[model samples]
Target: MASNIIHFEKDIEFSKKVVLNTSKKFPDPKFIFSETSWKLDQFQNLKTKLNFVKHKLNDFILEEWHEHTSKMNPSGLVVNHVRKHIHPDFLTQAWCKFYEIMCNSSLVSQKSLLTGNMCSVHLCEAPGAFISALNHFMALNHQSIKFDWLAMTLNPYHESNGHPDTVSDDRLIFSTIDKWEFGPDYTGDIFQPRYHEHLYETISKKFDNGASLVTADGSIDCSDDPGEQENIVMSLHNYEMMVALNIIQNGGSFVLKMFTIFECNTICRIYLLCCLFQSVEIQKPATSKSGNSEVYVVCKGYMGRSLATPYIQMFFKSKNHDNALLPLSQIPNNFIDELYNCSSYFCDLQIKTIEKNIITWNNKNESYKEINEIQRIICQEYVNRYKLKPIRWDQDVISSSNWSRARNNKRKINISYSEKLRRRDLCLQEEAVLLYQEIVNFSNSKTNECHEILWGRCDQVSLNISNVKYCLGKPVIQVRSSKFCNDSLLQYRIKIINKFPCIDSLSNSESRILYFKTKLNYSKNGINICDLTDTYAKNRNNNVILQYSCLFNILETLQQKSEDFLLIGYPLYTQIAVACFFVIASMFDTFAIIKPDRNFGHAFAFFGFKNLENWLNILSEVLKYILPRNDSYTRSKLALVSWLPIQQLVKQRSHLDIVLLNNLCIAYEVEPILLSFIQS
Candidate 1:
């Protein structure tokens, strides 16, 4: 046994030295000017090295090399052979290896034998190649086991600087030609513990006895330096194992893709997985290339959650620690540690030998240089075939030979400039003659109507109030009677007494009680008086009405008495109400106040005046105060009290119907009526 161990040690040392020597002859360039050139040079050197190793190896090993190289490109083989079944990519090979391990281990057969449905979870599954492979395998073999799948991957919606951080390839999903059979909501970075915690909670609720299978193909971006790249790859592998151990049920299986175990960190992770699993196997499937360092670690039959949870917790706690190895106490058994070390050592030796042999074979065969050149040429041809045409900025116009030929074939026709202008002038002359004839015909038809207006009954001196009332809707109530009806002051008054009674109507307690029944009836149909007044005031267009009113003079006088009255003394609503009153008063020939009982009164009484006599006293006082009240202004102002009030009073005594008022509020420029009511 001792001699056998020594022989194994010697073999490992020899393989390592061979690998080093093969790589050293073709040292990677410090700076590669073009990726194509670098790849071509590397390919030539690798082919030469591979050929050399073939001559040195035994017949069995050389046969395996021949089988692998005969395919030349496995991706091309996959595309051609199973082009309809699977996507031709590295992911397809990884998934094929995983499926073979599961099948060969009887995991799929056992699950099919069981009564319950099998649940599987896939981590970092974007482009969904593993899912397609699993679906294909299950469809072909284990039709008895109903499978439920959930997958987690980077969120395509996650943004960095307003652009998608990861964009999924839709072709991968569509290439399967089947509707997705898994839960699609599982998304986000798996490195985050919260994502794991969420999955744990979901599994606890939905899944019976946890998931039956967990597969992780997680990896991080690797650096060129082998040591740093190994560290990154191991860290990612450990994190994936940590999650798989936490979620996978007892008797469940886990398939992990990991690099060759060259570093202590990778070996340590494998040791931990071995401790928690009933069986562990490292496999490199035929689908995988002979030269690459990737291998799959298949762990089957988990040793129950009780045995794994504590180690899982410890892993999370010590994850931040710089040391890659777990504490001695964390190891479940001493035998696991020894077994893991032995297996890892063997794996490292095997990987080095394979890499060395590939390099030796490639270096020995000079024919590989021709193959490399051919590959570069084919690659360049493919690139050129698919490359997008660059934009051409030099050409201002697109030249079309077909269009030029068509234009050249057409017959030419031209006209003189003088002839074109003469034809246009002839058309204009014909239009002018037609227009003159139309005007003459229209004048002949309208002659009678024009004459009646020029010397009509409107010029007659016998036109009376009855004739004026017949012509206009309302009886003429002149400020000072003039010959023409148009000259008379027009007024409009909205009878809102029933709809909105004056505030002064509610002042006397006895009157309020007496009119309570009538007031209640009015309140039901009554619009808000303040809102109506405010709207009218806000929308008033004729500023001339306020400029000519006695109310403006009253406000100006009041403003002189107290400087801050506009700010503090007067409320805005009250000002709006007062402005509404003045705007209504100014537009009328005689401002009439129709009391609730159909009694005639002066308009001022509606503004809280005790009687007509009191209102007249205030009006006389206001007139005395306003200076330079000329004939026109004085007449216009007095017109507010002249005809309408007298007519109302006469109508009350005579028992006549009150005539409807005409258009009083003319649509013209007016100040905000509230501004007219702002007092001191």
Candidate 2:
């Protein structure tokens, strides 16, 4: 293949000189750059030189790659131009990298690696781009091979995974959630040792031996400490390697993303990789920006696991110890020289390109004819070399039978509200089971009075009413009812919240209740509820818009008060109702859902307003449909609830898993009562 690739092989004589024997003490890394070693000094000096230009030229250099160089690479531009659906840029980068590696190396063509049935595992693979890329490759080349794959990453939706730490994009995972293994804790954090064990066991069960291929594109944000990028990501690099070594099949191929090879930890890891695989090749794909230090290590033809067991033990055991793997003095002198040369080569290339980009940025009016010519040649070469064809795997991926199953599981697992009543045969969760027992006990009582149960729990502390500075004077809780709900039941629930006519009995409630009615027009057929089975319901969309407008208006008046909120009864059987519920729930720090009646869907109580401004953009999209339009172009804004993708809906939904579960528990309990009432 016509690509920039550097290959390394195991030197038998050099390997004999080093200690390959087993030892109880793990091979740890501890090395400092010394003046005596010119190779180390040279590598460090080049890095220092690169850092000098980085501050001012970083953005210019990146723009140069994105706007010019990467587009010149044929494979990089192919996917974007030919694929029907849009995807993350990393998807195309992964495809280009893998395509070059597969073509240049003996990964795909080798019979030993391309078995009839193959399995692969991707670590730190959120929003799964590499998996999709591989799927496309297999469909094009190895169509007869049965490919089964698994992936894991920091769970984006898990509350424990905070911002800047997890991949918040769920565009791909929303459809392929089942293929991911998020460990026993469901955090998908590979840094945790337990996750490694769980992933190993899972791979073992499916492949028996292990996965035929393992890929890890894990990295940490080192922008804060750019000089120590290698050091900052050293521990993660080790963990990824250990997991891959443990889960990969004998004669399998392993691909890992890494940075510069200057640090002792990095050099040691690369040397260890060279010893385990028949060949280790480092390549910075044409798609990757020249301004960055990112590169992929493609290791192929793994020696059997038994042979690597001792090294694996050392790798894991080194975690707690401060010992050195083969100290700086023990690694082969020839290998050290090769490492220094490789580091300097890439560093020099980066520095030169950065300088050129700096000039280009200053010259703002630079001609693009050269770039266009380069792009034409590369595009032609790529099409001819790979037999390129239009690829559209985004729809093909989500349209599988598993999509429906994953959607169903998402609802049942307390991720969202269920449009339909809970089925008796449906498996009940631990929380649901306990709530069911509570409901049965309540049903056996003789009292017929209306009641409100606090089934949902939110740990968020209520705002201190005295310290508040919002426009609203006191804490106010407004109760609202939709046309679909029973007005008598709604009034009774409001009375319960207000503790009406019992104020002299020494209660401590200070909040005042206000009642509002939704202006929904009821028809003979009632509200047309649409479930996930139906993508769109055209009849009752206007009612949905009216409800959205009412809620949006209510939200517009909200302030950051401690106890100012609305207790609303709305049916969640329609997509718009569910979307609007999420919008309201997300704006409050503390929220709960009440099942005021057995036949009702859900009644929500949101408290302590927060993040209201952030959601107003989406809510405002509904108003374009409600307002009068003057031009044809202005009517393009349809109801976001009906037009938005399921993934977008999932991403916008609040972290109200408990609230969903609480409502579902009531759904399960009320099923029998509603059934008996109907029979009578």
Measured by TM-score, the strongest candidate is 2
Model 1, 1-680: lDDT tens digits are: 74465345333322221100011111111211111111123323433443344334333333445544543432224322343433323234555455445555556525535764777777766556676566555555555677767666554222110112232343343232122222112125565544455677667776777778888887664422322444566656776787777788878888888765444445456666665676777665444554455567777778777766765666666534356354333324443345345444544544465655455565546634424443333333322332312222222011222122111111121333333334345543353343334333433443332211011111121212221110001111211111111111111111121112222211232343224324323333211111112222332333223223434444343323221111111111111222223322332222222221211101121111112233333434433332222233112221121112112222121111111100011101011111122210
lDDT per residue, candidate 2, 426-538, as tens digits? 43343234433544554444123323433232333221223211111100112122112222233333333233121121111111112111211112221112121111112
- Report, for every candidate in turn, its global Cα lDDT versus the true structure: 0.39, 0.51
Residue 255 lDDT in model 1?
A: 83
**With candidate 1 superimposed using the best TM-score fit, by how many Å does residue 493's alpha carbon deviate from the native?**
72
Question: What's the alpha carbon RMSD for model 2?
Answer: 21.4
Off by over 4 Å in 2: 1-39, 58-79, 84-91, 109-114, 319-325, 391-395, 399-512, 515-680
